[model samples]
Target chain A: MSSFAPVLHSEWLKIRSVRSQCLALAAVLVSTTAFSVLMCATLSAEDTSEAGFDPVRASFFGLNFGQIAAICFGSLAVAGEYRNGAVLVSLTAVPRRGLFYTAKLTVVGLLALAVGLLTSATCFVLGQAALGDLGVGIGEPGALRSVVGCGVYLALITLFAAGLAAVLRSAPAVMGFLIPFLLMLSFVLGDVSEGGGWVDFLPDRAGQQILLQNPDGPLNPWTGTGVLVLWVAAALWVGGRRLMRRDA
Target chain B: MTSIDVTQLTKEYGGRRAVDGLTFTVRPGKVTGFLGPNGAGKSTTMRLVLGLDRPTSGTATIGGRPYAEIDEPLRHVGALLDAQAAVGSRTGRDHLRILAATARIPARRVDDVLEQAGIASAADRRIKTYSLGMRQRLGIAAALLGDPEVVMLDEPSNGLDPEGIIWIRRHVRQLAAEGRAVLVSSHLMSETASFADHLVVLGKGRLLADTGMREFIEEWTTPRVRLRTTDDVRLSAVLAEKGFHPVADDDGRWTVEGARVEDIGPLTAEAGIPILELAGEEPSLEHAYLALTAGEAEYTAPRPTAAVQEV
Candidate 1:
């Protein structure tokens, strides 16, 4: 087998070389932090002190928007190969379908993790500043967890989209299906079922639990994130099988 | 030297055979022209050989190993299946650099191939902004980056200008001269005739002919004799009586099919016919290709008269 380091390096070069992909990565940070600040600025101190209010969750409100850019970044990394027949060239170089798919997803996951960490930290710091006196400190119970969980959440969502993109083989198709499912379907299911039952297992709804201070869902914060991880593993498994069996 | 060996290779898509039990060898130190009409499986065969597509049966090997089994196959075989295969959002240089990195080729080799392909000036430009000709050059540059033993190019001259076409011919020849196995696929017979030392022709996903370039043309077409005699009337009657079907032209020249120059010269001398001009015409590669692939075209236009009548 070829060395994994070179394949990883090559996949990284592929992502870094494309301007649109870099822009998408930047959008992840900008959208998440900007939205978090906006939400934090508009909230009142009285609301923060409310009986059921969760300031840690409130700080990550921008994650909803930032995940979209993260999704784009992930999908573009994989689907870009299908576009313009780039996959053929990629497969030609690597030859081993498994190796190519693993290296590509590894690069996407790592980049998303790095960017997700930066975005989460920025959103937390700026979001607390915007909240002023109502803000929670990092040392506060569940505050650090939310900040770190927010990064992991973004990376998982990105990989989820990437895995789907590999199966669909088109960025637009992956985006069209994932964005609506993340923004509306999961929330609608949660609202209709009153945040209980099977809807709690839905990827976005379940994963977002880590950012919350209160435990309302049946699954805890870690368990909820584990549910999302299962979804990601499933997606990656199906995507890898498709890549191995299909023609480039 | 590494060479491609395809034996009984077959690929079927949804019960439709794209490549049907095709077998051929591409040896080193020669340019083998892969000729076929559209949808005749030229690209499919190349894909299978490169391991882009899984063959339904049999095997395609480079140097006795499957393409997928070879470590860093780009260092063994370089291929240009499509000129537009590179991501358009990246610069030309970045595209080659990515491939070079994957194959562990030196970074400087990327610039070397760019200059060799004659696209160094536009290496920094986004590939989306490049013209078709420039994209072709970039694709060629990517193929040569690894400097592999076997080179496979499918329709490499598709969008090239006349100069670019000539350059590709010379470049292909040079690769073969350096003892690399070069298989160039094209639908244009004349283009293949210009540089190929061997020929592999396909018809309807089946091997139609596999032989040397000269032998293939000679085997498919019969030689003809053309004579312009001083006594046209007597010469024509004598040739007809001797069981030769001579096609007379308005320019006073007669053409006889399946007749050699020596055969005609002896007959004319015995008849005391004064010949102004008598010469043997070599069979054309275009004619041989057309004849071999006559009914094998997957998509052919209807005749003009037939279309007019139907309308």
Candidate 2:
């Protein structure tokens, strides 16, 4: 029954102390909103084919680029400790490996959640403004859910990257695997699978289910996010186990 | 007043043993020096104590429990295992702040420790810009943040300037004087000899010697008599005639082994030699360490070639 408040405070200070990690979080909002606005402004109603049009997803289109920033933020937060053996000092300060790790994850998770919500809401309002009559309202069906789901999606993606970073113990390694898998692999899998199959259940694709104006495939919006949550849980479990069993 | 007790602690990496059956107790109110050669398990043993690494067998306890079992561990034991273990981009003050927060210490203590470590002037600067000496100071500050009863520092004086080294020696002595247990590790015999009251020497992951500093030095190092006379040649001849072997150093001093000041004074007086300097030279910690680890050293540097030796 150890209190985690102090450890959480310390982890927050670690994240806030570095300029690059803060910049990474800020990028999540800026890149996602800016790219969504750009896409929305360029989109004309005449260009909308039934297969191509999805106003709710388009409003948060910058997520394609912004999510990378979120991943960088979470991965670096944990991986930076390993950069110069700072993890040894951290472990010394908090000898209970499980407590220290849980505190770290909590701080990163909350921060990502905050940034994710802000990015999702801002992208929605601004993208809808640019879309004119083509845009969906907050009261429209699935509109609020997609906006809120975008926030949860970003938070989960960041934690997922954080988990991988903890297990791998390097920012570059996490980025190398995550960036290609998220940006390229999803599209490649979609192409290989044609339209809809198990590929839609991939963590990213499954999570993005809520962001769509029209729900499709095997999972509902909440179930798709649940799949991403499972991925996050698996990653954190392995990372925590490694931290306890392996030598610092 | 708690003590660190390690009983038959062992750690194996793959097939090689990093720490093997090491047992020692570091009591409060003294600086126990952990001396060993490279790859001799000094760092590995410290890591095991801190619970940064799990032991393969046996146990290490602070007071009466393992490190993880203790609540508020920082308040019980403070350690500086590696001076360079700091985030480069964070300010020195912020680094201390983070650790201070984790220990549930007041924020004001961060400033106090920074001032105490003599790094107050550089506290606001980024750690990346700090010199190794500054980082060492910052690490020490972090260790003191919790004001624990036990302190462990590994190679604390390694990159320090003369003043910094003196500061550390005095600081460690003060910590011990305050009834805190201190365990400091170093490979340099001369450095540990300056301040450590007790010694724990290791070789190849095994304890080679564990005893008081003075006793270990006295038992292992030979006490010799050094004689500097007006007529060194005459002194050597007279000493040889008396069946005494005197080795002449480059400074024109004769080192007579297995003899005390009393033994050399009369011999020089009988030989009509004017003694300019007559002192008993106690063998240094370096000599005792060399003798203790003579056969157990992991790697030995090759002796100089004949040509270089002649020069």
- Global CA lDDT of candidate 1, please? 0.90
Worst 10 residues of 2 chain B by lDDT: B295-304
lDDT of 2 by residue, B223-242 (tens): 89988888978998998888
Badly placed stretches (over 4 Å) of model 1 are: B233-247, B262-274, B294-311
TM-score of chain B of each: 0.90, 0.88
Q: Model 1 - which docking category?
A: medium
For each candidate, the DockQ is 0.77, 0.81
Off by over 4 Å in 2: A49-52, B228-254, B262-276, B295-311
Per-residue lDDT of B67-176 in model 1, one digit per residue for the tens? 98888777888899999888998999899888988878999999999999999999999999999999889888988988899999999999999999999999999999
Quality of candidate 2 docking, DockQ: 0.81
Global lDDT of each candidate: 0.90, 0.90
